[model samples]
Target: MIAAPVTPAIATLNTGSSSLKFRIFARDSLDLLMSGKVTGIGTDCRMNAKVTGTGAQIAQELPGADQEAALAAVIACIDAHDDDWRIDAFAHRIVHGGATFTAPVIVTPEVMAELQTLCPLAPLHQPYNLAGIAASGRLAPDAQDIACFDTAFHAGHSEVVHSFALPQAMRDAGVRRYGFHGISYEWIARMLAEQRPDLAAGRVVAAHLGNGASLCALRGGRSLDTTMGMSALDGLPMGSRSGALDAGAVTYMMRRFGLDADALDHMLYEDSGLKGLSGLTNDVATLVASDDPRAAFALDCFTYRVAQYVGAMAVAMGGIDAVVFTGGIGENAPGLRGAVLDRIGFLGPVESLVIPANEERMMAIHARELLETRLELMP
Candidate 1:
């Protein structure tokens, strides 16, 4: 008897600073086969995975595993399971595509070079994202590698929204605002279109509140404006990242505090935001459960900023019809969501929703579309 051919699947990788979250989807059906992550890469890395719709699970400690090793371990886990699914394509969640790539594209050497130049724009994310791509290429050389950009969803923003009040030369040199958390917003838009067509057709403000938070204004399921600008460091205060800050304050810190560029970067990106404000922990659950006044103050600041941004997003679309929340805190923190909604109650009876962010699924969808398009164009 001849052996049956393995089923083709798309693997989506969302790589962070020290973590890689991944999911495998059936190529044709787009059904999730398995999902997993390798957290704390370069430290005491732990890899965990679960086969969808089953009791099969994987958990292991990978000592000193880097991004490439983590990916190799993920592949090993998938292979260990007799799922008989081969990863035919890798769909990467690239955080920044700069100003050129407006849509998902197959990764090429030229594209890789261009993306490398954008690392400065998203220092904390872009480099790791590119590392995932490079790792996938090395480990699965025959598989198609597709880059699904987080910035691609917001690439259609108008000049007024994307531009800063900088000099014409600086604006022309790609120093303009490039919104982040767009992949999550795009998933929210698609979900709304299918589940709540009424709101999807009208003005909607989506608050992706999490470790890294941002708000996006959507009109007819398209991004009109967002809070993040130029980098993920902008927008709402994150777990450890400073949100929007005064340029003057940064200059003052550099001069008064004797902070160099690296020191400033570390302080703003890793030592600020809720973590800095709370003086306890960045985890919302911890902050919410604590009796400490600092935690309460941090939570208050977070919700207040979220509400403020909602109003800004509402203004961007001329009116507000609905407010959708997603991401870790957005979907799970009912109190925080209610606080945000309550604060924005002055906008009149706007619909409120909590939609789970499915960025990995969105990447898989993009991978399938690109794959099918390639087949269609083939002679």
Candidate 2:
């Protein structure tokens, strides 16, 4: 039997619509011990996991699976290696905290219920996020579960930034800008503040260009405003989401095209964006490699939208000081980044840098903070 390390560990779970990503980290130093992802959850599912330091890996098919089953598999895989390893805290990346939660909080039955109410705001992500939490509770009944909201980092935005040009009743009913990609933005702010203090102190536009893409304007480690408003689907074109479609178009689809609400939802959330534009795969690498003119058009649209949002982000912060890209596409696709920057170069001599997404680490950090706060309050 392998002996567990002296330090406690944190299991961070990040669940998307069709995937569950997990990482275990040493609590004291925050070093990664293991990382894995389970993909195709609702279909021909598969899981691929590996021990971080060692080359040991686990790969298998997960037939007819869901997030709960996939999460259980992850726990089993971790325990198989080191049965004694203590997962002291379970941190989750919850996509929506709505207007109530401003920071990470210890999960309770009441809190979970409150979270369920906000699921309609983030239908694609919130329910799965809660499922991961519930699965963790069942798997490790004694562990402390913490929810680090993706919207928490943007909670400090001024009322003007969050306001919609609607009636006061609508604004009061939580119909206002609540930016997404905030966990990624929070991580970027912390990284920039540590690595490039000057840029971090000034106005900076950080673009998190992933499958679900958004841009944020940060100044002195705070979000001024962001491209995404009220929902995740209101920003730059994403891998599948139709970002920022006009309200009239949606109504036209319903009345003129006879599309029902469910069909429209599926079209906006599942069949749009780059995939719809290119009529091909949503994978950026594949799109970049393709000879298809449609692929080129999709890429061009993505870049142009990003550049346009950067201008808006700059306006939100009064001016641009630096531009940071960090996401699956932002960190890896230099061509996309260059295309965006070329159009927005007039906003420079703006510094440009690519930082990898670390929302998992950011969640772990929030979890640790909430834990410390609880400990300090203990008698």
Candidate 3:
């Protein structure tokens, strides 16, 4: 049998610390062509993706460990679907940009180097972020790569919003708030601008709840403030993170529990939050479904913390126009949405909306802009 020619489309990749997600979109309107994710990288990589709307899995699945191998699998999957598809560019969700990158920038060696230095700020994520970027360069050298920073969207915050009550030296060392989970919030911000322009122009609080969660106060579609400070673990209680933890307590734990840096990292990154409080699963669905008192207590803690951030962000934004939720737990978990909103009812006239998280799509949009602009500049 003769093979059919592959249709042309733009391929966008959103590689996380341990996961790689990709989507194919037609250049016109950038319609969703296909999407999938390779998970559990670096140790027993697992592939899971459902077709848009239908939720169908890919045929030749990539099973193994290692992020680079997983990435190769994603490339192969896309190539198989449309061998001739012209991958115009690649978009990456880079986690940190220090004080430099405030918007999407074309990837370069210097930019990558500056980002790598931020590994100390985001120890668990930055190394992997760099790894993913390097892999993309190697795997798809033909496509233009664009870096969309998770910290860039929050760079709009006022000095008062980002400042910490620390010494001048520490503040000068970039030890202030640099909000994370920005891609999710960025999408929500755009949704508000398009669907509810009035709210977008007014003060609003956006909670991006998921395995990793953060709240942002946005005024005029820009970040007025956010809960996360310098790292992803500083905001709301996440799937397995101890949010807003006392630095003193950490110091005490080191002396008392004989916990080293590595031990604490494992605890904060994988053993705390819902999993720690509930003594059960970190998955919100599991906790929500279970009748265990510990699970209920954990949910209560998560809800209360989210409500606290809303009030704080409301104060930061002056007042609140709307409360937006966008993330795995945000978009799908209506119960969580209600719990957070119910607690923040004291905030005047707040409307709630759920626009499913689309960081991958957002990346595609940025890549398209970068590509079109580059083409225009070519003599």
**Model 2, C-alpha of 37: deviation from truth (Å):** 1.1
Which parts of model 1 have CA positions greater than 4 angstroms off?
none
lDDT of 2 by residue, 29-108 (tens): 89888999999998988999988777788898999788888888888888886435688899999989999999989999
Clashes found in each candidate (C-alpha, N, C closer than 3 A):
1, 0, 3
RMSD of 3: 2.4
* Candidate 1 local lDDT, 48-159, one digit each (tens): 9999967688899999999999999998898887478988899999999989999999999999999999998888889999999999999989999999998999999999
What are the lDDT scores of the predictions, listed in order?
0.93, 0.90, 0.82
Name the lDDT of candidate 2.
Answer: 0.90
Candidate 2 residue runs with Cα over 4 Å from true position: 1-5
lDDT of 1 at 151: 92
> What is the C-alpha lDDT profile of model 3 across 309-366, one tens digit per residue?
8999988877888888888898888888898888988776788887788887777777
lDDT of 1 at 240: 90
Error of 3 at 193 (Å): 1.3
* Runs with alpha carbons beyond 4 Å of true place in candidate 3: 1-8, 49-56, 59-63
What is the Å distance of residue 241 in model 1 from its true position? Answer: 1.1
Best of the two (1, 2) by lDDT: 1
Clashing pairs in 2: none
Worst 10 residues of 1 by lDDT: 75-84
List the candidates ranked by lDDT, beginning with the highest.
1, 2, 3
